[model samples]
Target: MLDWIFLFLTISLCLASRLLLSKLSNTSKKKQTLPPGPRYIPILSSILFLRRSLFDFEPILRSLHAKFGPVLTLRITSRPSIFIADRDLAHQALVQAGATFADRLTATEASRLLTSNRHNISSAPYGPLWRLLRRNLTAEILHPSRIKLFAPARRWVLDILVNNLKSKSETGDGVVVVMESFQYAMFCLLVFMCFGERLDEKTIRDIEAVQRHLLSSFVKFNVFAFLPKITKLVFRERWNSLLAIRQKQEEIFIPLIRARRDRKQQPGNGDGKNNSNRIFVYSYVDSLLGLQHPEDGGRKLSEGEIVSLCSEFLSGGTDTTATALQWILANLVKHQEIQAKLREEIEGVVGSEGEEIKEEDLQKMPYLKAVIMEGLRRHPPGHFVLPHTVREDVTLNGYLIPRGAAINFTVAEMGWDGKVWEQPMEFKPERFLAGGSGEGVDITGSREIKMMPFGVGRRICPGLGLAMLHLEYFVANLVREFEWKAVDGEAVDLSEKLEFTVVMKNPLRTRLVSRRKD
Candidate 1:
């Protein structure tokens, strides 16, 4: 009887201890109010929620925002990713508290490999290195003065694009797949800027093939980012394929880099050369070659770093701009009245079809600017900016955002907010014109939470200025040159597909007639 009593007491004590521990754990959890999110399955977390391709998550995210509030958490892998769909919260985090949200989240393995371990500006941690590289790009290559120097290059590429379209129109049954030509034109322009040489069509096509291969395969490589060791062991073939792609990238970029370095080492191309004469002659690689990182005791950039930077410059300038142009042109084709209005604005500012639309003329064309803005508002390139990490624990809208949480602001959602933009679904350039609802609006969300397609604050795109110039210049010229009309029985489909950029699902096939008879 005594032995039984002792056993019963011991069992009671163990049960009591477990209850106390459970209570404490519950109390701790209650104290930390995390953002609202969907119920996640154990171990797998939100992996099941994610599509194989990350780009497909945009619609899912939009749906989630509708179900939950603007700010929500998604446990992707082990980390709790906080997504902010509200513009005010985005401004609060990314703009008002810049430093808190400035640092880039730790890069994926594919990104690390592609960027040569965070050496490039886009993926680099916000620090002296990033500052230095950004300064070099801005002051040397991307400055207004430097951009003006590229006018001749732009004009040359414009002629090529026009000719290519003309050739296609003649061959095809009045319909042409214009995305290829648009992409090639952009690649040609950027390649010229990167290497200061007009490469042959074959070489340009080769570079395009490799870059597209890498970008398309990026989603596949993301598995390595999550389970590096496991992925390598289980999917060796896939790993090897990615490595082969990287090898091809090096094969293309390395020779170009070496040639530029060799040229810089020559006598005539030294610092004593006149700045005015070399403005257009100098390539992006030349400025990079001259950069010395103060954080690294004045160490010059390595070949790998140069390759990564040049690749970034080429891809960033080419792919995104080209995709945007396609979208803008598609909208113009879809809305004939909008197109007529834009053409009217362009002609009013820069004269007739025969006249060349100079970069300076773009400043006077506000409706043209509005159309570009409206396009970006409707279709942002990336649904999310590259993930950002919180530097320290912070309170956002009464919810606790802990340190080390990967945060992404929903760029497309903010642009489409009905509260901010009336008839957000409609393609209305008038909203951005004088005395309209969005007049004097800032793309950079500094003063208030509004449209931020290019993002805002210190971490905004360095190429924003250049991107705007390219868009305006290209759109004006294309409109001035061609009457882009939909082919008979073929309507312009604006259905979007997620690629490296958000592209048209059915690529814009249009009939282009030259405004001027050659």
Candidate 2:
């Protein structure tokens, strides 16, 4: 009986091997007509080549493009994936074929853990619900009037940042400003904006701390994010940690969300102290609260959903803008002549001795605008602006990209591509200023982009206005207050390192010489 069972097992193994070989042969035949790429090896694609240096994915891709034309397919765990770096092809995929290219992050579980299953505008599919949420966000919360209404909040945050930086500059070991500190300050302000005038600094810090902690465990979290199905068995520890962090986040955000709701529904008492007569600034939360889950006509978002949306606000605004500000400063420090010219423009417009720089004043400073633009071109915060997925079957440059394939366009590569700009590596703000080789280069997302720091297409950042304000305002102020030099003798190392955002592997350490022209 044992001999018979062994023979049966051997027969079964032989049949399974033949079936696998037949499938491979068929797949190879189909791929022959598709764009040329490296030959696929079973299971090793993910381990050998698919996992790219997140920061420098562009260069590797460009090399691939050089070897095998613009559009090429790569295998991830035997799955065919498409990457587009060619400008025209990218436009076809992203803009003309907008709805066809949906967000391809397949970790529904990760989204659930991170966002508590809230139908976030970023996470929602291309449909009526997405349209509703996007419209609400655009019309109510992110509108020009609504943003202007939050002027107090912006001012309050800026004050905190400036004062805090000034205090640090005065005392501690030669005024070392961690770029992350600016991010923290921005995070605090946005938290207030989302939650209302609620959370104290310590409470806010705890929330921020958890976010940072979770972020540090990103590899562990992403292991789950990429393979959500195997997450329970494979990354149970990281998965649980992520869920735990989500719970902690809820402990803080839920009360604030509920309180705001309560305040809205509760009648105003006669006492002015209990004044419920406040006008709504029409924030992101307010817009979300008004949404209905179209599938079942479900009620507005639960606590978890609200938390995820708010998390995006804080995460999105903080890291991108703050890292951008740091890069702009580092560049200014590196190129003193440009910095001098910027300060001259700012001082000429606002006077060297002013009480504070106003928002209106930023418009008149064209050089400042150019400097900021140059910085974004030089150092885009999100290296690849959250991987956009192909939603439906599409062809780019005669190559077919099937639905559900992950697509990543090279942002940093586009910015530094020598084909687009001469001296692409040089820190030249004048490239963006008026007449230059890059005179026609469109930084505005209205047109097909040569470089996309805030991303391109329908998914372009709505906070462009606010982000510009922060960068220009803070940078102009910092340069005006101090003449930044690379710590007298030490060179400001320009080596790039990838984190949540690209930061200097060696942080920008510069000596601040007082530029008080008193």
Candidate 3:
């Protein structure tokens, strides 16, 4: 009923807009030097878009790329989405001319609501605020030194994971669904980092439920992006649902925020919460608590904005790492020889099967690191990075990128380029070792972008180092604890699914046989 009403109200407006655009498009066609793409049919484009899922259009886009060239355009909606698959062009725009293309796409109504109208780091325009937030995250929370403080949290989460998997595999046919465990483990680690305290299982799981709901339902609310004035009225229920999710987040997050704020003031919390007088451990929230919003009269972050920031911190840390971990593990299960090789390396480096794998220990095993890198190269968590908006009109490889045009890099395509990798489709950890083409490659893409799983340039994820540590630590330990085996009649499927991240279409279900003698 609401849908019909909004469509009814917008139909005439859309037709009028289409007629106006058809005239403008024709005039601009002669003047525009934009990349080759399907001609926009205005109203027909909108109707066709309404019939398909947003991310489902990738196949069509790939075909379009093949027909047109490395750089092509698609007027997926009224806005043209420019995609870059060629490495040199990516380097030129995102690296050589990064400042010119550093701006993010204009946020939708839903995005603005969630990001507090660009309050957080990722969505904020390229400016002082983005710099501040990114710096704080990198220096205060994600710095290598700061990450060492969370070693205990990772260990605790690891114990919980190993125990959970062992118990899970013991049931029935002994095949365990691992994504749930992987995601939960990440939530455990990140929540501790965010809150500065160890929360109970119930609180951790509760937070996970709300945060995951917000991420999964994000696309559903993109409808609220269009005609939000009318859609907000028509889609009141959806709007309400979105608000409820946020409200739930605040209800949980604020108390945690307050507790951290309270902890800072509490003399004993600095020493930790016991008669033993534990030294106070600072947290991500603690850093935010001290920050004054650069734009808001230097006012401290509002409770709502803190909630938004915390949500961003938690979401980024959780889903992307968890998705990557599952993919790496799934690949290990499918390729037992690779698994055996990595296991041998782990045992050799760590000395004893019983000795825990430390970060320094990880540094000693290049092959273990190579396996994690290959997994990222093979299955980037996000196929295309968050769309980038150009700061001004610019030409790349003779194609015009108008000011404010949204650009995206085809991340998976770059990783799979046969020209870049001798055989890109095959899982090959050896590619990262000495004498291979991928040897000594830099992920930051400062010199040239070969493959970017966590993206690159000014807007590259600040959490890159921390994420790599988490992957290597977790993957190394998981492989150390269990000899992963494929379930008969249930092959390890590598097919992709479009989620908040590009996840395994079939979440990895594998048999875990204990390597440790009890």
Candidate 4:
């Protein structure tokens, strides 16, 4: 017993000493010449405040920026992270130094759970595979012609939503739709985008149920992700649940893929007899089947890669868009003047002759576009853009950001900066109009990061065009048909809570009266 105790003590001491020595060695190389930030601890660098309220991060970050200047060094876990609030510095990093910053590998739990990290655009590093997937998405699915093909899907969703609203008003039960209806609509649209056809409503519901469970499980586990590897072993149940979700998603997706393959392989007696009769592939699955790396000339995507990519598209498009739509509508509800003006513009331009508003019409309404931009800026759904990793040691504002450090930038901060906007806290659309400073601020461009709601640089959200279209189409039609006002006794709550995006803690509850007569 005495010998065993001695040996254990020796082993423990040696491990501690080695860890201390390693940390000290790394610390020795850090250049303290950069912008100032909180001092680093031995471990748990800046993680103590991660659990603070969603709104707290910005104020804290801004305080640091105020004291430290545009760039600051933050050590989250003994790893030096560089945070940039200055537009110039951010532009430099994203445009000029883009190759130096790439996506960090998703933690093991996130990869196993989200399935978003497996081989999808978001998870794949800056490399040949990433380029292949992004190019295929842009060329085959998100191209102008392909988006034009999706017009029918948008019309279908609009009809369903209008019918649902009419039914709710007739019943007069005052239904609390809380984000779920919005999420369902988004999921239906994106599911069709991924699978090339609409599944039955029951099928869509079943998939959503499983996905919600999986998302909740994934989010719960992600909070503890920065902990040591051994801590992950204790999270077996969460992992198991995630695997079950993966299995469920695969079961639904594989049959569709198999059907498409079998159809392509069918014998046609050399006459192409059934070619015209076969269901045309319109969604991203077709693109996946055709993808080839530009540099390598590799074969088509493997089954796992396809599954992961589809899952990422489904998940990304669903939650992010749903959250954003609700936020936009919530603002419209809070400010009726804004909604009325948008409806008036739509009516004047499109005129209600019973024709569905075409995609091309969205471009003609500058005020509506300004309102959308303001909503995106005021309430950026994603507060913290996905954390980026620095690949090499580099100096930003004279501070050394060491290689292999994980950095997270504040997206909402740039949009809400008081210096940039007059009365930044208020919801104002006029600020983004023709004569406004926001006129030339393209959210997609990296010339300067005035407000990066969709992020900036190479990793900017590729689906920004789709997101903007959804917002405009839905907002225009909803306003044309209904007058949104706050419930007499109940107010629209604007408080926020964080998940993948900054969502309203209390969903905006309001009365939707028909505008047909009003």
Instruction: Give the top-scoring candidate (lDDT).
Output: 3
lDDT of 3 by residue, 292-379 (tens): 8777798888888888899999999999999999999999999999999998888888754555688888998899889989999999
Per-candidate local distance difference test = 0.83, 0.71, 0.87, 0.72
Best-to-worst ranking by lDDT: 3, 1, 4, 2
Across 43-101, the per-residue lDDT of candidate 2 in tens digits comes to: 34443332444555555667888999867766644456676667766677677776677
How displaced is residue 518 in candidate 1, in Å?
A: 0.4
Candidate 4 or 3, higher lDDT: 3
TM-score of each: 0.91, 0.88, 0.95, 0.88
Question: Candidate 3, after superposition: displacement of residue 293 in Å?
Answer: 1.7
Which residue segments of model 3 deviate by more than 4 Å? Answer: 1-12, 18-30, 48-54, 268-276
Of the two candidates 2 and 3, the one with more favorable TM-score, higher being better, is 3
- Which pairs of residues have clashing backbones in candidate 4? 34-399
For candidate 1, the lDDT comes to 0.83
List the RMSD of every prediction in angstroms.
7.8, 5.3, 2.1, 4.6
lDDT of 1 by residue, 158-247 (tens): 999999999999894878889999999999999998988788989888988998898877777766665455546555777889878888
Global fold similarity of model 4 (TM-score):
0.88
Preferred candidate (lDDT higher): 1 or 4: 1
lDDT of 3: 0.87
**1 or 2: which has the higher lDDT?**
1
